[model samples]
Target: MAQSQPAQKYGPDLSVKLICPECQIPNPNVVEEFSSGDLVCGDCGLVLGDKVVDTRSEWRTFANDEGDDPSRVGAASNPLLDGVDEFETMISSRDGNSGISKELQRAAAKSSHGRSERSLMNAFRDISSMADQISLPRSIADIAKQLYKRVDEERLLRGKSTDAIIAACIFIACRQAGVPRTFKEVWGLTRVPKKVIGQCFKVLERAFGSNSPSMTPGVDTPTLNNVQSGPEDLMARYCNHLSLPVWLQSGAVDVAIAAREHGVLAGRSPITVAATCIYFSSALFGYPKSASEIGNIAGVGDSTIKSAYKILFNEKQPVLASIHDKRANVRNLPDP
Candidate 1:
């Protein structure tokens, strides 16, 4: 009776050359013969090796298999944590008999390492809360967290209030994301004064040097003035707050865009321009919101809105004429 050949194992894709001993071929094709568990010479079918092991991954799928397989073990680890991705310590609630001792817990709390860890945790928690309060997106929150981490790593938090540093980081993140939040708004939300936040922001920007994530490569750090909102950007938002009609809302946008196009908006605060646009558009459309009403919604004085409105109206006649023509055309359209 013929002896049974051992089953073969398949190896991964690899390019290798080996001489066949039996065939005496200089470089015989030595493919893994998986069915017989041997590495054999293709020319003579001579088994040169046996009992090979297949080291490929066991998880396999076919063309007809559903892609939503639930076999995944867990989420991928975050690289920021430096390989220690899980919590190493846990607090025990029970303090007597079967529980951890109070003295040990107290000692752990008093340690310098524990104090630093607690400070870091508290700062991050405050960042999350502030981000949520301001309705910031998750990407901005992540940027804030990254900035805070860098501050902590650089020991820049030594003499500064943690709250101030966190607020400053969030402010920078808001600017970087072009979210249009002002320092005044951040101060109102965080209760950290503007001066302290400003100082912290400057210190962080200095410490970050060329490595600052907020600064684009080859672009200088933007001044506070550069990041402020433009008139057109703020028009719709202020209009919405006042609950104006669609025509007035759209007219406000057109006024803002025209002012920008004609350079009438140069060196003007966007809030002021947006306020003026609202007041002007309301009057032009015959709904006529008061300067005081528009100013109150925009957080500017009525006098400022009035002054900006006159300048915009006088300097942008061509734009105003075009808008007037468009409105006349709309009114003349036959009702369906």
Candidate 2:
């Protein structure tokens, strides 16, 4: 194919389609030679035009007939998966296609997403979806993916409760990211039994050493921290959910932290301690949060909240004394 040379004159888009210039022929049979950017006289063999733009695409691809892709490429590979190079085969969708073709389609679809990749994809999606449902941050989703990837790489808990493991991954992601959620809250979101989730958590804890780095070396995924978040950590979220006033929210957090420091609610779940602090804070500030309300949000019973508050009541001076804000009048705090 010869390239078109720079012609002195460029013809208008074959205006001579109506008639021939030199031959005086009407409605000339002109042919477009797109390869060399020329239009020639189909009958008289004249160079009717040169330097004509081809107007055809110059790029092509070997990729599956995906729309608008001019280069040989496929979807971006996930770094989280161990396998990449997964192959695919296209099967005709037209009716009367042989059963062999359908079989080939199924095989290709399965191979295109390798078993490990498929599992990781599903787990990642579940983690993200669960996080969104619980109103957790995007960072939690990313971290959870990383943690799950590590677990997969190590082959931890082979053939075990994968859902519980995934739920535990999310549970750990929340605590490790510092915006912790209680196990009950995680249970509420995942519906995984708390005992099963806890068992899976232990497996993950050993897999990714709680006080140190993960099992694999040179991996960028950080080691898991203390999985159990403190009572004070729960107060901020619980207070916000209760819609307590700003002063009362702060006062509640202060009381919770003080309770933890003073061992006021020892052997109690962080959720219970947090609910107690909220109920106590409301009472002190005259904002009155019934045990039922706090219990419902905190995933504890009213009796549990009242019981914990009863214990927390005995240490009112130590807890309220920790409040630097003078607005929380100790004189107004009721004795339980």
Candidate 3:
């Protein structure tokens, strides 16, 4: 069947030209005489529905209160296709861009918070105050700072308590700094609850690993002559006894010293003192004897030796040279 003819709709007059507010393009679908008042722009998507407006003539007035909304009035007055449109778009674009830029800046600021010097100083201050509050040794407090840096870099500490963090830092610093001390000794100085140091250290270790990558095995000038041996030293000596490299053997000695120092001066645990001494000796001197042998020499146990060695791996360099050399020939050693 053939389709019936449809009636024409009201539209703009053909003589009238309407421009799209958004694109500012001339409207092509405007009818010279229309049934309805609406006029749609063919070039752009702008739809003009007001019949009161002339189809053939240019419009200066707005559909609603043009002065009320600057954004809408601005767009209508200056279409996107014209120079006016460019200005309006630039303004609108700035609004969106500003919001995105603000969000990015906020994120960057948050990320940099932990890295700022202020943040580090704050952390140091907090730790120092905590040490004083708990009555931990000054050496232990200093060591704690080092450990805190390591932990912060590792991203393992998520706002843990100052007490917990201090204990962990102390334990790690003692081992690394060659300060052998016991949990009891630690408690005496820190005034923290028993085992808190060990427990928090375990958490830190599990999160950041039991060992640190930057740990060096050597003693400094001041600490070179300290013969306090810990299990770590015994372990180093044990490695040495097995014909380990000279560096390794020497490192074992440093580790032993660090462990021992931690126990005696830092941690203040006699049990750790003997154990650390034995372990370091075993590791550094190539002593093939088990922990039992070295522990016996130090008047401790095999378990203590093992535990002290475990602590030693995180120890820092103790003496740059052997104690015998430092005592005999101060000038003989190379300048650091």
Candidate 4:
């Protein structure tokens, strides 16, 4: 039997000739070879490849070169370009889908119009940066986005200023986040007037309430708690004289008494006013806080929060002792 011969290799159909830089001899099919960069002549081993070519169109591959290593000549020049072709293909396949096509077209148009796209992208980045800087929760950030959308819609639909609308959105977001930020917070965020915030608050409240009627306001979801007023405002309003310490003590006692009194007035059995008094006084003082910290617990700001320290601790001592003993079921009540 005769020995089998090796399979013959064929050249490209539209091969071009290239002059070797080394040998000055003509080298053909430089554009057809899958290899790129400097190429050597098959005969004299001289560099002959055309470095400048329309890479996307005039490229080829050898049998040995086909593998997952995209580094192969003409496979993709750079790692960055490796997945780009596939991505473009995927995008093209989805192009006929109305929504996807519209979005892609919009993005393409945006890219084509460089200035507006860059500016718009920068604005989005700024919004994201602002959200991160403030350390807003996802719920709060979503609320902010909703606020922005609402403001934009309101401006277009009802003819409001952009500033007013943005302020309204931020105000609504803070409130929804239970941040207790005031009109001042809105003013600080948007540089709008307090009255502007107030006006927008009314409008936004009506809009939100109309859209979601189930969201009625209550103590737990108090409108004040949503606003962000700084501690300075409440601190400025502090009139109680027994220092911060005595005031907190008196406040706690007074809050307890007030709750019990209110329960009595309502003809209910007087129970522990631990949460209620702290909550109520927290609001009145504008220091608005959670239930567990101020009332049941003892601290400086806690005491005078309920009333002026003098009234609860000095004048009405006996009444408090009685209530205290009753609360703990003590056999003997002590002096206040």
Candidate 5:
């Protein structure tokens, strides 16, 4: 007679029983161990089964009050991937017995939609690379990306170069963020022609003009007056760049402000005005700087600085007189 195997313990509270056929007794004392993969009888010392399979939940939960929590199954999605959140299913080339044939995969690769998607992906990748090269913040990069998407949606890139448009978008984003980057800096980083970037910038400005509040969030929209930097805006920076004394810097700022109020800055670039202010203040304080030095610091030329200086000195005599009086008063005061 054959012996029957004892049932295994599937769980803490669940088990199975087998009758011992060799002993012809329904034995309740049965031990099923996994070390030798056998089922044996405890009372008769008989081996009833071998190579038995254990069936139970592999997930174990410690602490009777807690429930089982499984891990997430897939990778997280990215917004930069457009609308496609998951990888495209492709036919495996290594599996010869697979049901998906090679012809279908080849056809999918040659589709027009795939080509366009690839072009857009390449453009966005370039934008991100350019942004990082220029050390732009993540928020500005995201804004630039959104601007590029809008330009594409409007079909404005049909005749324009992609690199130029992306450069212009980054430039505008920097301006809106008040990052103080210049067109020359942007051009140097992107290697795009300055004229092309300017044209693209004009197009973007027209597209997101006063009516649209989309591009200039957290900042005032660009306007005719606010678009250009003022002489006062460039004064301190130019002074710092030249390493001038604090008194000279304050005097230069005063001269620039006076020039602005007297219409000396009308129809003139702020850089030239700032250079001229620094030059005039330097002369009055007996610590004069050359026009070339001032021009270099203020990003203008010597001739431009000379012309601005002539205009301010020839037209604004009272303002210079007031600055001279202030200097005299400071000189007359006793040392602290």
Candidate 6:
């Protein structure tokens, strides 16, 4: 027997040109009556169409505007995750006495939530927790979670250590947020080795399509660069850590900026540069902090601070001269 072709029933053509029957106007301005689902003519009241779909958001509210929406169907969707709703079917253990609970758990696992989705969910939770542990703001947590999602989706670091990836994401997120933290700071929170985090950071840098490309290892990669923080950015934080006055921070930042512009602080890391500036700035302000104290806060050794100070001493003339507005008096600044 030959297969019969299915008969096609003609339906109303929505795209067909509409005109007001009373006024005989072509393509008349049609207004939608959402309450009755009728499209009426704008110039003259005429029902051009009926039963049109309403395409507005389903936002319900209580008596208070946008508050306590009891009739709302579901909670807001997370911008970071893929699930339409975060309402997972969780099964209670019930003191390990209920077999039904285990059965429910297995059933829930087999439902819409797959292994990969669960992994992503766990990763996002961990990212938020880690951010909270370090007292980082919610914004940083969101950004890190986004980076983790991107790396996983793009397979940019396939077969790589998830811990390392998370650590790198945290580090990158901090730099991108303009609160540039040292790898040492990130390393303290995440026991992942600095070498591994650094490697992962490089891989992520390639993922960006050519914005903020300079990847100098020890330099302060600017905001959105996801590199390291510069000495200038670290000045206020270090000053606060050391209980130094505000003037000291301002002076130290100027020194770092001058050293950066003159290209004299190339070989030193940002931490070392920052430490040296604080030390020099402290001396100028008559509140000198011991090298060991500044080194302790900046996460560098005392010897490293001394070496940076020696280098600064050699280039002291231009570094001081380049300060904007002559903030630092050449006579007040001391020899390293």
User: What lDDT tens digits, residue by residue, belong to model 6 across residues 1-336?
Assistant: 999999999999889877788878765787899889999998888887899899877775566665644555666677667643455456788946858888887787777767777788888888888888777888778778877888888898987788789888888878776776777887777777788888898888767524432233465435454345788888888899899878768888888888888987698878888898898878766787899999888889999888788888888888777764666343465655
Give a tens-digit lDDT track for model 2, residues 121-201: 778878888899889988777777888888888887776666787888888877766787877777777656788888888
Per-model RMSD to reference: 13.1, 12.8, 24.8, 20.1, 15.6, 16.2
Worst 10 residues of 4 by lDDT: 78-87
- Residue 299 local lDDT, model 3: 47
**Model 3 per-residue lDDT at 335:** 15
lDDT of 3 by residue, 138-253 (tens): 76666577667666666665756556676677656555556554444345556556666666777766654434433334733122133243444335434433454555455444
Q: Worst 10-residue stretch by lDDT in candidate 3?
A: 80-89
lDDT, candidate 1, 113-225, per-residue tens: 45556666667668888888867887777777778878888788678888889988888877666676656657766766789888998887666544556434465544443
* Clashing residue pair totals per candidate (backbone < 3 A): 4, 0, 67, 20, 0, 1
Preferred candidate (TM-score higher): 4 or 6: 6
Best by lDDT: 6
Better-scoring candidate (lDDT), 4 or 6: 6
Q: Using lDDT as the measure, name the better of candidate 3 and candidate 6.
A: 6
Model 5 over residues 1-336: C-alpha lDDT tens digits? 999999976656445457776676754566887767888987787898899776645554344455634333445544655654344465667657664567767776676546656666667777888888867777777767777877887887578888899888887776665555557657877666788899998888777655333444576545322455556666767777788888788888887777776777567766667778888777766567788888776667899878777777676566755566656622221111
Deviating ranges (above 4 Å) for candidate 4: 1-135, 154-163, 177-179, 212-336
lDDT of 4 at 227: 41
Report the error of model 2 at residue 143, Å. 1.7
Ranking by TM-score: 2, 6, 1, 5, 4, 3
